[model samples]
Structure formats: structure tokens, C-alpha cells
Target: MSEYQKPLPIIEFQAQKEFWDGCKKHQLLIQKCRDCGEINRRSVRMLCPNCLSGNLEFIQASGKGKIYSFSTIMAYPPQGFQDDVPYVVAIIDLEEGTRFRSNIVDCDIDALKCDMDVEVVWEDITDEYALPKFRPLKQGS
Candidate 1:
């Protein structure tokens, strides 16, 4: 393994495991409230934000979104991303009205723009783990 791979995020609990398991399967999963049909992307609260009910389940997301905002990383890389110093980190607003932060890959950093259409691309970090990334959608795709 590479040095950067040694310090990966720990999936310790059931909630975390469930989320990461979907990643391993190359799927973008989001928590949905059964009570209110609300989708929770960033928040991990057990209760539904709309109905205050404790019935939530992870479901496959559409894997489509637009870039809300972004930053280019040119230095001082994080432990697992040392090899990828020059990269784009972005907040993507999904079509489902939820947003999540992830790396923007497979495109020129200089070409990135806010509101650019993007789609999910999985980075298989290991046999049991994957990272959900985004890439600019092609014009005709």
C-alpha cells in the first residue's frame, strides 16, 4: 500500500459502514427519511429533519449534480491525498436538492466553474472502500 493509503477514514459504526458499503459498490447513497421523503446528504442525524421521525434509510442517489463551490488544493495535502496535491474539492448540489462535498476529478482545474454540471465517479481505494468523486459532464452526455 502507498503511504497515503495507510491513514484511511475509519468506518467504525453501523451508520458509517452502511454509507461506505454503498461506496464500495460504486453507488452514491444518501439518507432518506421514510416519514417525510426528505433526503439528508450532509447531516447524519438519526431523526428526519422534516418530520422528526427516526425512520431513515440509505438509498441510491441519482449521482448527478452541479458544482456549488470549489477550491483548488495546491499544497499541504491531507494524509490520503498527498499524491494528489493539485486537485479540486467541491460542494455539489444534487438534483435531489441535497449537497455533498467531494473531489472534482478528470478535468482541468483551471476549467472548473460554479454551476458546472457534474456526475459521480467512483475511486476504488481498496477492496472494501471507495471514494465518490465528481467529473464534469460531457456536453452531449
Candidate 2:
């Protein structure tokens, strides 16, 4: 593929490293607290946000979700994203009970609706990185 011109994630810590690695392998990983069984969607914290325990593990997510909310960007596109105007960005509520933010692709923007079913689709932007975007679930899928 052509070089990815968009701003990439800054992986400055071990958790970030692991999270990005999982993404490269097409896996969506989230942190699970060992102490309280709480799932932390963000991977930056070393301690469990729910129980304040320094025990956490990465778990693969189901990657099936519904659109909690969304917005269609029609103007003032960010740097490196000028060609991708009129795209939909959404907050997805995953089946595993965690929320994730990603762009919605491969569907009509006017057809988007709240709570619409979606599933993960990877864009291998680089050899070492892949972005997990969401798309409307196909019929009977």
C-alpha cells in the first residue's frame, strides 16, 4: 500500500506497545482488571481504574459492536485526511461492554443510525500497524 500519511498513534509505553502489536495482528485487545474483574478499554493505565489494583491483563475483544453515536465530518478535515472528507466517526459499544472510537467505513453516511450493528475491519496502513475501523454489518452476517 501507499505510505500512510495520517498521524499515527504514539506508542510511548509498554501497554501502548502491546496494544499496537495486537492491532497489527488484527486483534482488538483491552485491559481486564484481575482484582475487580473490570474491563478497561484504554490501555495507558498501569492500575485498574475500578479497583486501584496493579493487576491487569490484556484480553482480545469480540470486535462486534453497535454504533453508540456518530458524526459525519463535512468540513475542515484534519491534516493528511483531506481526501477522506465526509467520513463518519463513531463511538462503538462493543459486545464485551467497552466502548471504542473509530471511523465507520464501507457504508453510506446517510444510512448511519444510532445503535446500528457494526464489526471491525482492519486497514493495514503500514507493515507494522493496522487501524481497526468499523463498518455496518452485512445482512445475515
Candidate 3:
């Protein structure tokens, strides 16, 4: 692939390292609290939000979710994303009961709607990183 000009994730800690590593392998990972059984969508936190416990483990997510909300960017695109204007950014509510923000792709922007099913699609932007984006779920896999 060509050199990616977009900003990439800054992996500063171990949790972030594990998260990026999982993404590089096309695996969607979330943090599960060992103390309270709470699953956190963000892996950057050292303590569980539900329970103050540092005992957390990484678990692979199914990468299936529904669009909780979305917005179509029609103007003022961010730096390095000028070519990707009119894209859809969405908040996905994963089946595992956590939500995260990702871009929706491979579908018509006009056809987008809330509560629509979606699944993970990786963008292997570089040799060291593979970002997970979402797309409308196909009728049959």
C-alpha cells in the first residue's frame, strides 16, 4: 500500500500495545475486568470503569455490532482525510455490550441508518498497523 498520511494510533502502554497487536492480526480485542466482569471497549484504561480493578484481560470480540448513531461528513475534512470526504463516522454498539467509534464503509451514505447491522473490516494501512473499520453487514456471509 502507499504511505499512509493519516494519523495512526499512539500505543504508549501495555494495554495499548496488546490492542494494536490484536488489530494487526485482524482480531478485535476488548478488556474484560476480572473483578466485576465488566467488558470495556477501550483498552487504554488501567482500571476498570465499573470496578476499580487493575485485573483485566484482553478478549477477542465478535466484531459484530449495530450502528448506534452516525454522521456523514460532507465538509471540512480533517488533515490527511481530504480524499475520504463524505464518509460516515458511527458509534457502534457491539454485541458484547460495549460501544466504540469507527468509520462505516462499503455502503451508500444515503442508505445509512441507525440500528443497522455492521461488521468489522480491517484497513491494513501499513506494515505495522491495521485499523478496524465497519461496514454494513451483508445479507449472507
- The alpha-carbon lDDT assigned to residue 78 of candidate 2 equals 85
On a 0 to 1 TM-score scale, where does candidate 1 land against the true structure? Answer: 0.88
Query: For model 1, what is the alpha-carbon lDDT of residue 82?
Result: 80
Q: The CA-based lDDT of model 3 is what?
A: 0.91
Arranged by TM-score, best first: 3, 2, 1
For residues 1-141, what per-residue lDDT tens digits would candidate 1 score against the true structure? 243354566765677788888888888888898888888755566677778888989888899999999999999986767877898989999988899998899998898999999999988777778889999999999
Tens digits of per-residue lDDT for model 3 on 73-100? Answer: 9899988888999899999999999898
The regions of model 2 sitting more than 4 angstroms off are none
Model 2, CA-based lDDT = 0.90
* Candidate 3 weakest ten by summed lDDT: 38-47
| Model 2 C-alpha lDDT per residue in residues 12-128, reported as the tens digit of each score | 678778889999999999999888999986645778888899888999988899999999999998888899998998999999998999999999899999999999999999888
